[model samples]
Target: MDAITQNLDLFWNGFLRSLTICLWGGVGSLVLGTFIATCRVAPVAPLRTFGTAWVTVIRNCPLSVLLFMFAFGLPEIGINAEYYYFGLAALIIYTSAFVCEGLRAGINSVSAGQAEAARAIGLTFTQTLTQIVLPQAFRTSIPPVGSVIIAMFKNSAVVGAFGVGLDLYSVGESLTSAQGFAALPVLTGVAIGYLMITLPAGVGLGVLERKVAIAR
Candidate 1:
């Protein structure tokens, strides 16, 4: 209580920063992941290979390594940016692989006959995917996609460790190390801050899942 009250501004700013990262990262990952999933299931052999390689390499790589590369290595090639953007990029890139896999599973659940029918009727691959397959695939994939997003939100804590910004983890670190506060209270506050974001998101996803199920 004392630690949090004394440093309200720090906590507030940290909370906002974490939220911002999650928001941008979530949208970026979903869009990129969807495109990758589409490519993975496309008629073109080269696209399928590219998508496969992307998911394979990225899924095998550690998130921390990606963050290190983005945070430190990018500057060597003169593609410098703020640490915040670098961290967000890492988060999106890392999470998008998982998102791609989840969506690909959903896309696979769609029947092959439907795609064959669409082609027989002169529907292009793009039309077949966007109009028929992806809509159903998204519905089928809500739960897994929601889980990925939740994990990404929690993972955002690591960003501050790479000096991305003064996020919740950094706030706790500052209070405990620099400000001489007890670690317990400072960490508790930080956990609560994360819960504030994740809890509502989890509940909202639950409601969405139920609604989607009902619609089906």
Candidate 2:
């Protein structure tokens, strides 16, 4: 309590940074994942191959390794950016693979007959996917996609260790190491900070899931 009370500003800043990471990371993953999911289901064989390869390689790689690559390897290739962007990039790339898979599963859940019906009505593959498939797919995919986002929120803690030190985990580290605060209270504060983000998100997802289920 004393640790948190004494360092309220630090904790608040960390919370905001973590929230920012999650916001951008979540949006990036969803957009990129949706594109990849579309490619995986497209008529073009090359697109399908690329999608498969992306999911395979990225899903298999460890997040830490990806972070190291984004944090260090990007600079080596003359793509200099702030550590914050690098951390966000790593989170976006890693989480997007799982997001792609979740959406692909939702796409598969969509009835094939609807797509065929659209095709028979002179609709192109893009039109059928965009108009007929993706809408229903997104509704059905809310659960898994929500879960992935929550996991990504938790995973954002790892970003602090990789040099994005303005997050909750890093704040706790700073309090304990630099300010001589006890590790226990500092860690408790960090956990609460994360919970403040994830708990509400979880509840909101549950409500959304129920609503989608009712709609279905």
Candidate 3:
């Protein structure tokens, strides 16, 4: 109990940092994801092929490896190390690929006639996609998108692997190193912190899916 009280600040800071990374990755990836998904499903075969390759390669590659490559490898190529952004960049690349597929699936769920109707109403392809297609697709895709959000949320811990300061997993390691006596309790606290981020979003996503289904 004393140990728990003593280390609350450390746990709080680390969890917040981890969460910040997740939030950035989640939102950043979605923007890029929508664009990539749209282009992948474009009539142009070359765009489709390139997008497909991007998604496939990122999905298959282990995230830790991606982190290693970006954090260490980029500097060797004259890109230099900016720790937070490197993690953020890798995360954006990784999660965008996934969110691309998720959004693509959601876009496909919308009927082609809806887009045709939007075009009939004087909306350009971009406007039709933004106003008509994506809005509804977002509702339908709540679960999948939520899953990706949570995944990015959890996987942000991987950023700690590259020695970024004060993220949750790294903090856990630091705590273990600092207080050899309280390692179990410290890690358990970290686990709970992660659940706090993950579980609520998951439940909210379930509610969203149900609401969308009922309205349909």
List the global CA lDDT of all models.
0.90, 0.91, 0.85
lDDT of 1 by residue, 1-216 (tens): 899889889999999988888889999999999899889988999999999999999999999999999978999999989988999999999999999999988878888887899899999989997988778888879988999999998999988877775888889988898889999989999999999988998999999888876243
lDDT of 3 by residue, 1-216 (tens): 554568889888988899889888888999998878878998999999989999999999988888888888999989986788898889889999999999888878899898999999899988997899889888777778789989998888878767787988887888778667477787888888899988898888888778786254
Question: What residue runs in model 1 are displaced by over 4 Å at the alpha carbon?
Answer: 113-131, 214-216
lDDT of 2 by residue, 1-216 (tens): 888898999999999988889999999999999889889988999999999999999999999999999988998989999988999999999999999999988888888898999999999988997999888888889999999999998999999877688898899988898879999989999999999988998999999998886243
Model 3 alpha-carbon miss at residue 52, Å = 0.8
* lDDT at 18, model 2: 87
lDDT for model 1 comes to 0.90
Global CA lDDT computed for model 2: 0.91
User: What's the number of clashes in each of the models?
Assistant: 0, 0, 0
Against the true structure, what is each candidate's TM-score? 0.89, 0.91, 0.88
Judge candidate 1 at residue 212 and give its lDDT.
78
Give stretches of model 2 more than 4 Å off: 116-131, 214-216
* Pairs clashing within candidate 3: none
